[model samples]
Target: MQNLILLLITAGSSSLCACTIQPQAEPVPSRHVSTIVIRQPRGEPGDFIICNDGRVLVFPVAHPKTCS
Candidate 1:
């Protein structure tokens, strides 16, 4: 019937419209982190340790410098 042909045509057109190309999402920017390396002291007096949060810990004459 004419109604059945029209229905088929409408369905085909709807499916074709549904197959459209969409714009892709934007890519996120990557972050670069910088790391600082701290060397261990020779257990000498006046030796210091710099923590990750910019805290300075100085060792005494008999103790070793360590970050908690």
Candidate 2:
């Protein structure tokens, strides 16, 4: 019982003394991701298509006349 009380006191005292209160950091500025709006030409088949999500998509243009 004495050992338990002594252990508790030692732990409590050490934990209380080991603390360091540091200054709080400043709040970070709100970040705004601005998108650059560019006028993209319409893409033909086998050409690049500028998507609304800022991505380029290209698909093969199959000419049915050439597929004889």
Candidate 3:
């Protein structure tokens, strides 16, 4: 009876050791690119607006003007 109890205890303890604890890996950082839109001043006249992506956009003149 004592040997049976010891065997049961050893089997239960060995099963608990099967699980391993490991530190979680950190996530890799990612790079994001954003586009910004720029509008010309209400009364100012300009040909184009410079963009962050190295492109110049044509500035459309507002019709009938806009209230400040």
Candidate 4:
């Protein structure tokens, strides 16, 4: 029927309009290493140190003020 053909055409048009294409991004090399130091409160979670080169160091909670 003509109504069935019109319904099919409308569905096809809506499906085509819903399609999208995203541009891909090129990866860039890192230049410098980054360092992060975290010192949580005593008896708390702890501390963590991370480097940009995928290095990680973890230590227990300690107070420098008490020792110095």
TM-score of each: 0.30, 0.31, 0.29, 0.29
Pairs in clash, predicted candidate 1: none
Ranking by lDDT: 1, 4, 2, 3
Task: Give lDDT for model 1.
Answer: 0.80
Residue ranges of candidate 3 with Cα displaced over 4 Å: 21-68
> Could you tell me which residue pairs clash in candidate 4?
none
In order, the Cα lDDT scores of the candidates are 0.80, 0.67, 0.66, 0.68
Give the lowest summed-lDDT range of ten residues in model 4: 59-68
Better of 1 and 3 by TM-score: 1
- Which regions of candidate 1 deviate over 4 angstroms? 21-68
Count backbone clashes in candidate 3.
0
Q: Residue 17 of model 4: what lDDT?
A: 70
Provide the lDDT at 20 for model 1: 70
Candidate 2 lDDT, 1-68, residue by residue in tens: 99999999999988777654545578998699789998755765464567667776656566322211
lDDT of 3 at 11: 92
